[model samples]
Target: MAELTTLARPYAKAVFDAAKDQDAIDLWDQALAFAAQVAANEQVKVILAKPGLAEQRKAQLLADCFEEQLPEALSNFLSILAENNRLALLPAISELFSLYRADLERTVKMQVSTAFEMTAEQQQKLIDALSRKLERKVELESSVDQSLIGGVVIRTGDLVIDASVRGKLAKMANAVGS
Candidate 1:
């Protein structure tokens, strides 16, 4: 996963830069997302993996899959990826592009896991507090995980706050074992 991300980073950065310059970040975001979905299809993967297929054909096939006409720059980008046999990196590239977009827009996506589901008010309070602390808009995605036992765990980018009963138990166990 990390290797895929590393390989995709340069492409994502270049795409993000181009989108920023053209004031088409949202458009590029949608395009990349759609491209990634298309690239992830089993049939598409089989076709893309064919050794005899020409790079331009592969690129054109991808572009044609889009319902909307792609911008010239995006078509060129697809050509470059096809030329380099990097179409498989589209998902990672799309994810990285989203991260870049979030940074540019001063927003952060956070994942919250709890043993029980969070109420609307609880989610709002958490988002409000995180926004105040991080000084950025907070987008919360929450899920209930019974294994958490109690409390909640929040994750955003590289940061994680584990406040669950299971987490505390594991910490104590590790400390005693150590």
Candidate 2:
């Protein structure tokens, strides 16, 4: 939700800055992803909602949820979140942290869906084009969707290029119906 995003942004920025300074951006990204998954567990949700539970207990429960012990910096960050009663904001924090990391690294991830699998050459070409267009290094992930009928659909964040035959037919059908 918007409120959670607003609440999580500062924490994410703080994590990003800290990780960047330490040259541990990748490590922090992995840590946040794991923490976000832990915070999303149903049992954790129940515990986090318990008003009478102390902040330390909530933080401890979160730490215990992780498969392994958190690193010192991440543990300290989690403790701060617990102290602020913001342990529930981990998912939003992870999401915003990822965005900040991507921006810092000048990387953009894109998806290409088509009716048939693409050759490596074709995939590389798509990646090159997207890198040039977006002015960022592009990671192109390919998927086959028979329902696409033909051609492809490229999705990058909020932007979608619907070049698939299915998409074209749908547009034509809408035009004719109108």
Candidate 3:
């Protein structure tokens, strides 16, 4: 994971710089998403690892796949990855690129996990609470986890609020142990 991040960092920075300069953040995001999807596929991974395949052929395949959707700059970026045999890092590159974009936009992503599925009202309430706490607009991604028993666990980047029953129990146990 560390190596992947190391390999992806420069590419992500370059893409971010280009996107910012051209005012094409959305275009770069879409292209990166497509490239990431391609990289995640087993067949594409196999093809990318094949030493027999020419760099031009790989780039052509990428171009053909994204002909209508990708802009020229994004397509050329994909070609650069293919030439350097760095296509496998597309997913990591996309992740890093998203982080950079979020930094630029002053937005944060929050993961909210609850014991049960939340209704629209519940979700909105959580979002409102998080926005008030974080003092920023929060983009929430929610999930259901029966293991939580009750309450919710909210994670925003490195910070986590584990309010679940299980977490509470664990905390109590730790206190007793200490």
Question: By TM-score, who's the top model here?
Answer: 1
Please provide the root mean square deviation of candidate 3 (C-alpha atoms, Å).
1.9
lDDT for residue 28 in candidate 3, whole number 0-100 = 87
What candidate 2 gets wrong by more than 4 Å, as runs, is 66-69
**Each prediction's TM-score versus the true structure:** 0.94, 0.90, 0.89
The TM-score that candidate 1 achieves is 0.94
Off by over 4 Å in 3: 67-70
Quote the positional error of residue 2 for candidate 2 in Å.
3.4
Q: lDDT of all predictions, in order shown?
A: 0.95, 0.91, 0.87
- Which sequence of candidate numbers ranks them by TM-score, best first? 1, 2, 3
Whole-model lDDT, candidate 1?
0.95
Give per-residue CA lDDT, model 2, range 34-141, as digits (tens): 889988889888989899999988888788867877788988998999999999999999999999988988998888999999999999898888888889999888
Model 3 has an lDDT value of: 0.87
Query: Model 1 — which ten-residue stretch has the worst lDDT?
Result: 65-74
Worst 10-residue lDDT window, candidate 2: 61-70
Clashes of each: 0, 0, 0
Better of 1 and 2 by lDDT: 1
